[model samples]
Target: MKLLLFVSLLAAAYAHGDCGGDCLKACRSCTCDLPNDGPSTDDGESPFQIGNKYSGDCKQLICKDHNASLIVDGKIYDRLVCFQGAWHFGYPEFLEEASSAMCLNPGNRTCPDDAEMRYEDDFKCMCKPDFEDMSDVFPDAPEDILPLCTNCGKKKLRITFLIDNSGSMASVIHEIKHFIGQLVKFLKVSETGNNIAVVSSAFSYDVLINWGEQSHDESAIHDAVDSIDADGQSYLATGLEAVKAALVQPTDENTQHKLVVFTDGSIKCGPEALKSLARAANNLEHLKVETFVVATNSRYTTRLHAIANGVEDNVFSISSEEDDEMENLKVAAKLQRRICA
Candidate 1:
């Protein structure tokens, strides 16, 4: 009877004002103070209560489940919220209980056993990374749950480089060599086994090096690249045709096929055939093509753009106006975003 009466009194106190109305019962020991309540509109919403969790709203991927909540060390926190992908902080209304839950304690090692803090572009943790942002294919429908990345086993990702070795590329071969070296480094860190191949075109075309399968022979790839010297004409169509034919042939469904082409000139060998080959390669369900042109010149851009399956994001036209080092760095950064994201 005494225990029951004590519980009743504690519940009453909890209902009144446990932590000065700033936090839920679970975060009572948290030391951070709430931001200013500011002004409340007639609708009963205020800056202090709504928004202000992160700098702005999350963009890129929407949350699968917004109503989800989690209990950590006896405290409740919002588990899932939608990201509008607008790159701002204008999220729709969230549960009132989620306000204090966003302010996590960095020092406390009391995160839930199943979840880890999510870092955004700002690298701060107001969200959990486990919640995946779905592709924009479904604009209107939101999913009930976000799928988590599985580490069930290692997968294979096949990367093919269609390098331009024309006479005009002599000036930029040094930059290209550095870029490939960096690419090897990036792939080395990936969770999957990566297979690297090189196909170059000049007055003639040749597969400089082929390890047969996805091999971790970084030194071999580097050696093949080192052996390449710019001396022939750019025959882009021939290279694309060869790549398209190879991609359509039988291969493992588990292997992801990616073709990255580096060029600076037009297809001197065949123009019409290049278009057909590019369209065919893009249409291949198993292949993704990303092309980089060394010239910002409109003529070069148009040619590379067409060869990139008409996707602007996949076509990177580096301007000759900038220093070679700077341009290569930019290309490396952009590739990191696409490949690592």
Candidate 2:
């Protein structure tokens, strides 16, 4: 009788062990037979009464029938089973959460192909180096979410400014300067990949700021603009020729080239000079030239419009006689919108 009792006790112990110590109250036939009465702790040894809870890696789990239950928003729904000593979700609806919860730190978080996980005040996915941030254009986007990123290679632009520095432009030089300053601010020239070059059109064409020369420095570009002064005659054709030469230089295939001309409707040479200007402007292979005629008289408007390929949208006229300050601001704002588009 003593030997039989010892063997029975040994069998009970083996059954309890096979149940992974989850059957604290009762282990019947090598299984937990009691509901809401199992080990609540992660170690699987202590008994958990009804309504007891256990904290898992991603979520808090409640004990029910020796299995962990998933509770979301104060309601317990699905059961979580123990696999390899860790609680795993049993339902497909929670799979995404399970995968995301594996990342305990930013370094472990997975990001999209164009982005990478980073930590600032908190863990976030940010755009990679070769990508550009397009946040400003999306004003209605959520504040907490990061903006979408775009490829830098596709959005590159190269802009050249050809300003007429003839003696007739003395009255509007300051306005031109203000316009240039506002444009620089709007373009975020110092922070972006776009390039700005300034060519002065007078008795001769002078390249004040060459392509990629101090291109990223806003203060330097402004200083160059400030140095410009009204002098000599407007050699418009020569200026166009210079701009054509500059645009012909090899650039990235994806780059969009633009020429912005600020003239006071004065050309030194006669009809032949106009023809020369037209030829020079027409021969530009991949350039979009915009003409801004700033003058008090409408004498040169027709000629300048012709030079702009008769596109009224391409030619902007600003009258120096009416509200100089307001007109410059309004025209500058318009140019900003067009260029940024």
Best candidate, TM-score-wise?
1
Candidate lDDT values, in order: 0.49, 0.57
Report the lDDT tens digits of candidate 2 across residue range 199-252: 898899888887665765788789889999998988877887887776545555
Clashing pairs in 2: none
Model 1, stretches more than 4 Å misplaced? Answer: 1-155, 189-192, 246-248, 269-298, 319-327
TM-score for all models, in order of appearance = 0.54, 0.52
Q: lDDT by residue for model 1 over 1-341, one digit each (tens)?
A: 64564464345334433333333223322322332212233454422231223422221112222322232222433332212211112223321222322222234333222235442321222224432222132233222211122211133556677787888888877667776775565454232466777888776678865546324577878888888898877777677666656642466556566677777755564656566646654655335444433343456666677666667777665544424544554455456345434
User: At residue 202, what lDDT does model 1 achieve?
Assistant: 73
Model 1, position 133, has a per-residue lDDT of: 26
Candidate 1 achieves a global lDDT of 0.49
